[model samples]
Every structure is written in C-alpha cells, then in structure tokens.
Target: MNESSVKPSEQLSRTLAAGSPLIYVVTWEEERLEQMLARASQELFGDDRPVWQWTAALGFTSGPGADRQLLDPVEALSFVVSESVDAICLMKDLPALFESRPALVRALRDVYDHLSVRPGSMVVSHPSINIPPGLSKEVYLLELPLPDADELRGMLGSLNSGFGEEQRVSDEWLDRVSYATQGLSSNETRDLFHQLVSEKIVDVDAALAEINLAKAQLLMKENCLEVITKKYDIDKIGGLSKLKSWVISRQKLFTKEAQAARIDVPAGILMMGVSGCGKSLAAKTIPSVWGLPLIRLDMNKIMSGGWGAPEVAWERAIRAAENAAPVVLWIDEIENSFGFLNDSATSGNMTIFSSFLTWMQEKPANVFVAATANRIEILPPEMIRKGRFDQLFFVDLPEAPARIDILRIHILGQGGDPEEFDLNHLAKVMNGWTAAEIEQMVRAARIDAFTDGREITYDDLIHNIYRIVPLSKTMSEQLNALRIWSHNRATKAH
Candidate 1:
C-alpha cells in the first residue's frame, strides 16, 4: 500500500533488498510473479539463494527441500525462517488455508518478525488476500500490473517463432496481435499463444476472434458485470446534435494525426439529463460510431451482496473495465449507483468511491468512461468540479425537429416506412416526450397494425400515441427540478 510511483517489480526488489520480512503480492498472475521473485532472489542473494515455491497441492520445489511436500500451510510457512539457507518462498493460494487456520496465521507473523535480518523472504500471492491486522506491519502488498504493449509484443513474437519464414508475420500482424492482447495477464497471453501453436495457424484475423473469445469467457465468469456488444451506429441516435458534433470533433484525438500533434485523449463525458432521454443511447452511439468495443458496468450487480463483499465486487468490476481498455465504459444512472460523493457515505461506499477517484486520476490504461445520470442533484460537487470528465451535457426532452428524427429512426427500425407516416405532424403532437417514450409509441403502433390485420394506418399511430404519457408529463415536478439543477451546471446536449 505504499503510495509511490515506482513500478511494482521495482517495489518488490527494493523490499527484498531492505530485508523486508513478508511481501504480499495481490494478483491473479502467479506465473509472472514467479519470474519477478526469481529475478529478485538472484539480485538480492546471488545465484546460491534458492527461489522456492509452495502450494497446498505442490509444496517446496527448487530449493534445499526439493521434492519435499509440505501440504500443511503452517509447515510450508516455516521456510520463511531457516537462517542456514537463504530461500525466497513463494506462497500460492494460501488465503483459504489461512482463513480456516488461526495457528498458521500466528506462525506467519512469528516467522516474519524472526527473519528481520536473515537473507530470506516470503512472497504470498493470491487473487485477493485478507491479511490479519496483526501482521499488517510485517506484510507489504505489491500489485502486479497487467501485460503492457512491449510484453505483449514479445509474447506474440514467441508464437511467430513456431512458424516458418514463409509464414512469418508482418509488422502489421504483430502490431494487431499485441493491441488485441492488451489488458490480458501474462499467463492468459501465454495460453493464447499455446492455443495458437496447437491449432497450427497464426492468422491475424483469427487471432482477434480468439482474443475476444478469451475476453468474453473472462467476463462471463465475473459476477458483478455483463458485457454489451456494440450493434448500433452513431447515426441511429435521434437528437443531441451538439453532443454529436463534440464527439465527431474529438474523434480526431485518437487518430495518428492527432497523436503527432501531441493531443491527449478526451477524459470522457457525463451525460446528466431527464429520465427516458437519449443519455444512455448517446453514450453507446459515441463508441459504436467510432468502431470501438463497448462495455456497460452493472452497478446493481456490483452492489449486490450475492457478489461477495461490495468493495471486492466493485474492485473486480473496475479491473474488468481496465482489461477491456481502449473501449467505452458506460455507467448508467450514476447518482443512483454511487450516491453523493460527499464524505458522509458508508465505509464500503467510501472505499469504492475513493478507488474510482484514484483510477480516474492515475489509471494507465486507455479506457474511455461515459457516465449517465438522471438525478444530478444527488451528485456531490467534488465529482463534477473538473478533470474527472471532459464535459457535462444536459439531455432534456427532444424539441420539435429532434422528435421527427427520433420518430423516423424508430419507425424505420420497426420495418415501417417513414414516408407513409406524417413525421412532422407526429413530432408536434408528441411535444415534451423523451426519445424512449417515442420509441414505445412506435412499438405500440406496430401492435395496432397487427391487430387490424392490414397495413398500418397513420390513424393507428396517432391513436396509440394519445394513450401513453411521457415521463416529462407524468413526472413534471421532478423533471423541472432536474432542469433547474443542470441549467448553469451542464452544457446543452441538443
């Protein structure tokens, strides 16, 4: 938990050199962490100090007690001592054992304290570890970063080595493979390569599908989030001309030309608007139009008690988003999810909130965040003070012209020809209605068309439109309050 800018690998080296008793690595990448521990062992204690690894299933390997199996975690933790031999012990998946055994925890603490001056170190690696408060001072936590572009490139090059010169990959293929493998752990990337080698094919196009398949599998296993595939074009969005223009201009920020000019990536947008407006749809359109993958975070799932602890669930969701970087992350109904950013939140909420703020400020990945909220009043000032989001746009009820656009878009989508319906007249009649309400009206008209057993008549649409009321009409007071809150606070989206 040291708040330094040094890399995690460098942090581990420094800790071992300083004779730190126990180093806790919080990661899922045990394979890569082994490489770090091995390098550190050589650097700190020369080649003579053996780097030992232990698991409940396979214990005490590559050290003085080679081939010896210490299945008991307490017995295995004894390697942390033994001044006669300098050993770097890697503890794998010991959290479950520690949770059930209190004596092992005491032994770990005792061994940690006793090995203060010895040339020995204990490295515990787990997906998530709950260290006892008693050993908090003795244990130092290290975070293993996800594979970067250079590491990915090397991994892909290894795969290419298996192919002949005639099948050697071009620079473009290698670049695409590296980019596609971004956010994957070192072990995952290696698995991808192993699969490629087994299949005896290394086509770049096929690699993309396999990489995404791996990502989809990872997401399916997560309890706190779901993956949303981009299927719509940006033009499908009805209104928000101003917002559309902003996105079109900012699209250049990601281009090679913009990079040449040293332009930074836009932070993202916060679309605060009335309920049923195009806020959520607009967020999707931005990435869809840009040909970028998109993912939506399920805040309800994240806050669900069924998904383990809320803080842990939230952390997993954040890491998932990071892994799916260079993609737009949509968090809908933000205020209802995170609550006011004011300091008066529950301890769990505060931890989640702080983690988000820290990531927004210091995240190294290129994940573009697009958040939407219906109730801006509940949001705290610190969240919107600046720097978090590039712009805050207010999406109110569509005006007369935008209503026509929404009607046409939805009608065409429902396999109905817009030319048959009087869109201009319908737009005027559906005054103060949100885009979502208009979409439902279109569906209602289609149902009426089927009920009549004939081609749809304009009267069918008009009749159905009168039966349903929009959110603005049903919740006028609340809508007005939100409008007032966003007047000076946000830019007009339309």
Candidate 2:
C-alpha cells in the first residue's frame, strides 16, 4: 500500500470499520505504527480526553500517560478493557505470548467477548503472521508491506529536516535509497539512513553500500537467499558448446526485447551432471552473462526458528528475487533442499519446498532461474521433468579436446606460456580425470616446482597427476551408472 499520501486519520477510519474486532497489522516498523496511532488519536479524541492503555510491567494508565505501560503488551490489553469508547489495545509480540500462555489465550477471548459487546477493539502488530488456532477466528490479519518510494521520500525529508523547508533530500537520492531498501521496512530504512548520518558519511553512495550490507545480513538470516553481483562473463567459461549455444539463443528472452516480443523468458535451467563438471559455475555465470543480478540460495539456512513461518521466508526470498527482476536466481546443490519433499516426515519442509517449486514453475517469465545439482537421483522427479527447466544438460567430465582448451586457459590465466607445455602429453595423462582434477593437478605441480625454487615443467605435472587418485578411479561404478542415466535424458555439454 502507498503510505505517502495516506493520512493517519483515514487509516484509523478504515481500521475502525474492519469487521473483526481484533485487527492485526503485520509490520516491522513499530515507530511508524506508533506515530500513526498517536496522530489518529489526536484527531479522533482530541487532546483533552484520556485514552487508557496497558503494558505488562506498568499495569495500566491513560493517554500518552500510559506510554510506559503500553511497552508491556499485557498491560496494554488490560488498559483497553478499563477505558475509552472505540479504544485500541495495541499489543506487541502478542504472537509469542499466544504460544507460551494459554491464560493469555483465555484472557484474549474474554477481551474479544467484551469488545463484541462494547465499542472498542484490540490490535496486534507484528512483522509477520503467526496466528494460533485459538486466536485464528478472533483475529483479522493484514500484512503491511515495506515502505514505497513516496513514504521513503517523506521520511527522508523529515530526516534531513534542517536542510530547509522548501528543499530536502533530492529525488535522485530518494530513488537510490528506495531501491536499496526494497525488501526492508520503514524502521529499517529510517535506521539505516540515521546510521549513515550518525557516522558522518553523508555521501549517498556510502549510504547505499551500508544499506546493501544490511540487506545482505537480512537475506542471509533466511538461509536460502543471497544477493550477489554477477562476476563472471560467459566468454571466460570454456567448452560447453551446446549449453552455451542454448543459453545464447535465449539471451534476448532475458531482455526488454523479449518482453516487447511477448516471449516468456522461461523459468530456469536444471544442470545435472557429475560433480565438478561446471554445473555450479554455469549457474553462477548465467546472471553475469545475461546482464542480470544473481542471488544464491543455500538451503542450509532456511531451517532455523524465527518470528514467522519458514514458508514465509521462502516466499520472501523468491519475491525479493522477482522484485529484482531480470535477475538470475542460482540454487546450487538443490537436490538436498527438494530431495525429501516427497517424504511425509519432512512435510513442513516439503510444503515450503513445494511453494518454491510452484514459483519456479509459474514465476513471472522474466525472472530466470539457474539451479544446479550433482545428483539427479536425489532430486524429486518433478523438478527435472521437462517443463520445469527450459532444458536439462549433462555436464560430463571434460572430453579430450576440451581438456586441452581447459589446460591452456588455466595455464595462460596463471601467467604460464601455454606453448611451453606439452599439451598432447598432458591431455593423454589426464584421461578419465575430471576437469577439476586436471586443474588440481596443475596447481599441485605449480606448488611442487615452487617448493624446489624451479619453474614448473611437464615432469612436475606428471608427478602430481600420479600422486593423486582421481574420482574416475575412486567412483568408477557410480559415474558409469550416472552416465547411463543421462544417456538419453539430458543434452550433453560436450
């Protein structure tokens, strides 16, 4: 909702007529809510009348006099019962109380019963919905979203108060701040702005960086979401001819051109293959290659306890990605996250997983996803099913010709002369080794030569190769099984 032009009095009128006596305003910014309520009270009841409110520690009191009591939610509820026609019992952290105390539940029921007969109501404000079954029928919930550009501008104007009445923060600065604070609440936005001012870093870019850091922490707390700038260009990654061609073909689909052409950019790609074959690299690189921002989702972070549902966190992550549209979302090693969604034991987690699955399946066509998995066997079949990914590609170990290119690329990258090395001998020696193993061997050889204070030689690399056991030797059976699985199912990257 646009909070810029929304006057407190108008919002109060809407709250008053809402059918449910218990109105829950889900928002992270308590100060904004407080300011709105205070302004509404001044308009409706006038400064002369007392408005009794309560809080836990302070028992009960009236009007602004009850500010201390209102800080403790139980007292606030008690105060609502004791006074004021059309009064509001504003409770904070009421959701937490609902889980811990059945007495609070009964007390709330009693309060609801009284409010049904009387002319007043009780209101709970939280960052998210956590309605217990007992309070579900009694409470009406409304999620208050983050502050829009106009509201942020107003806040910025107020923050820069002494800058002059006619001129305040510039529209350009406001635009930057608005974008930086996309997923944050009014309180978060205000706090970040104030923090920048307090630190005396008045430059807008510094403030934007500070906000970005805070946003990173907030998204990290969710575990499954990350905000990252794409770092690698597609040209830098070698030897995925077919996959590269496929991705290049859809390049326009991720741009405004595709939007005008009414082409659905496609949801995402599923990269299935043996480990260390560039699945992860490809996923991370797509955002950069396609000129989209990248967000890496690590499912390990989503299982924590919090103020809201885990599903809400998933939705928030997905929404943030979509909000940053024309963005690439990289869900690396995704099989672990969705592997058990089919199991009844992980139903809650499964439910959350399915929500993500649905989004990936039906997300706005512009939000491209690039998910990578090492083990296709563990992934829920539905995920790899044709339509989920525009295409599925198998990233096998580098073939003979690809190995030569990969070695040359790595050697050149390390300031070594590619012409100095015996490429044919190295490729032959590295047979059955994964690209990752070849890279590792080159690193080991470099270190071996450095230890002896000598330049690396072909002999050093051969020695390194012999020293380490490659996956081809260790997991031959499994690799063969996997190759069979991918034979007809996926497009080969070779």
Which candidate number maximizes TM-score?
A: 1
Candidate 2: give its CA RMSD in angstroms: 6.7
Clashes of each: 0, 9
Superposed Cα deviation of residue 39, candidate 1 (Å):
3.4
TM-score of each: 0.78, 0.66
What local distance difference test score does each model get? 0.77, 0.69
* Segments of candidate 2 deviating more than 4 angstroms: 1-16, 35-83, 86-89, 93-121, 127-135, 146-177, 193-212, 219-236, 241-266, 286-332, 335-369, 377-380, 399-405, 412-433, 462-494
Which digits, one per residue and each the tens of the lDDT, describe model 2 over residues 1-494? 79534654366556654535687888777667766666655565455343344444454455544545355554555545665456655666677667666667766776787788766567777776888778888877665555554576677767777555444556566655654465567777778777766676656656655665676666555456777742676665557778888887776565434554666667788888888777887777776556555678656566553535666666766776654444577888777765453443266577877787787777866567788877787666877887788888888888878788878877766557889999888888888877777788888888887889888887887898789888988988988888998888889987
Worst 10 residues of 1 by lDDT: 252-261
Report the lDDT tens digits of candidate 1 across residue range 87-153.
6788787766766888877888877877776777778888876788777887888777777666678
| Candidate 2 clashes between residue pairs 3 or more apart in a chain or in different chains | 51-63, 54-75, 54-76, 55-69, 55-72, 55-75, 55-76, 56-72, 223-301
